[model samples]
Target: MYRHSATPRPYTTVVLAMSTDGKIADVARSPARFSSKSDRTHLETQIALADGVLFGASTLRAYGTTLGISNPQLLQLRQQGGVPPQPVQIVCSGSANLDPQMRFFRQQVPRWLLTTTAGATSWQKEQALGVGSFERILVADTSTGGIDWNNAFQQFFQLGVGRLAILGGGELVAALLAADLIDEFWLTVCPLILGGRTAPTPVEGEGFLSTLARSLELLSVQTIEQEVFLHYRLQRS
Candidate 1:
């Protein structure tokens, strides 16, 4: 088992999926699509549990995600229970893409854009954020040139985020894996064969905790129907 931090709060994660062949996308040819209702439900469940939800802006544009609970009654109950109406939806992009008209921006809950430069987004090029105080956080170091997970976490800590659920496109996931930042990996491998000559896997690069294979150890495995959900923990030597 990996030794837990005293606060037990490294970057928490929920890598929900309906991927077959252990790949996030069907092939490198196109965008990945979820094939199971159960998998989608699992993602929604995780979102409800988090204090904040984060991902890359490219994933945001690709997935067209609007972070909100679907069940109105449940959402109301959670709000009544002091759980907050919605988790802070966070995005990491070097160039800010402020699409104020997007449903996510329309929502009352604020969003955080962790950016490296003030270069405008395509959306922002057409129209700017006319309202709301959405955070535009500029990282101290541009040497990495992208969102630094450790630095981002320090920002999260300041925002009072205790737990986080992450939805990632491959690149961001790879970054988290390399940084050894992710707390848990929840993968729902679907029953489809996607043979792509060149495609991305669950994680990539020489980063994350990969050097120490023992850093992430399998904790549980289960197959509900045709889908497999693999859960792993960061193991310490």
Candidate 2:
């Protein structure tokens, strides 16, 4: 299935860390560590408030994530608050080459797999989403280019997906920002010195926002458990 997103207020978030030296991951290929319990708890708590969770396949592969937050108490709290028992987890695979056995697939949460033309594979999407009674939600595959972003956003809106929290290791955030689709950002800057050549910063867009020198205005800045949380908005200036 082809998909695209021409959303007006897609709440794409960029959540990650930066050390005193401005490093995000380890220097020698090690998993990034979270030092602040307060930051971790706060993030998961906010995640519980989101209608769904989105991330890229590269991020999943790097972290080996299931995409479902299964904390008993937290899930219970979310359920009591009338949120979905389990949030829908969406993965953007511009190449459509996601692993079938990744925890994201094994978990009981509903999964939406997005891909591009050069990346879209029929069998993989079907097997991954279990849309036999129907079909796996096929997002636009724009690998070779040509995506229907408007339709993608309409479908998500029809699905009652108004708010979205985009968790990242990178690429997805870059794309959303490039599209000028994100409305808000919840960024976390961690205080650690896990230097890495491969691990990247929060957003990789060139110039300012992404190659065009767009500016994001800071809305709120807070520190919890030694981590810095920065809330921002797209600058009209």
Q: Which has the greatest TM-score?
A: 1
Model 2 bad stretches (over 4 Å):
1-9, 27-29, 70-77, 122-135, 146-151, 196-198, 205-211
Clashes of 2: 14
For model 2, what is the error of residue 235's alpha carbon versus the real structure, in angstroms, after optimal superposition?
A: 2.3
Tens-digit lDDT track for model 1 on 1-237? 123544334358757574566566655435576557777777777788778888877667765555577767768776886988788888777776655545666666767766664433433444443553365553523464555566767667667777888887667777776666677878888888876745656665554453555356788888878888788866654
Question: What lDDT tens digits, residue by residue, belong to model 2 across residues 1-237?
Answer: 112333343454555656666565565534556547766666676677677677766677777664456668989987787878766677766666656655555567777765555555554555667632112456664445644555555556567666677776555666666676566677677776666566566665442533566578999999876678888876753
Superposing all C-alpha atoms, what RMSD in Å does each candidate have to the true structure? 3.8, 4.7
Best model per lDDT: 1
Model 1, 183: alpha-carbon shift in Å? 1.1
Clashing pairs in 1: 2-235, 2-236, 19-190, 177-208, 178-207, 178-208, 179-208, 215-235
Give all candidates' CA lDDT scores: 0.67, 0.62
Which 10 consecutive positions of candidate 1 have the poorest summed lDDT? 1-10
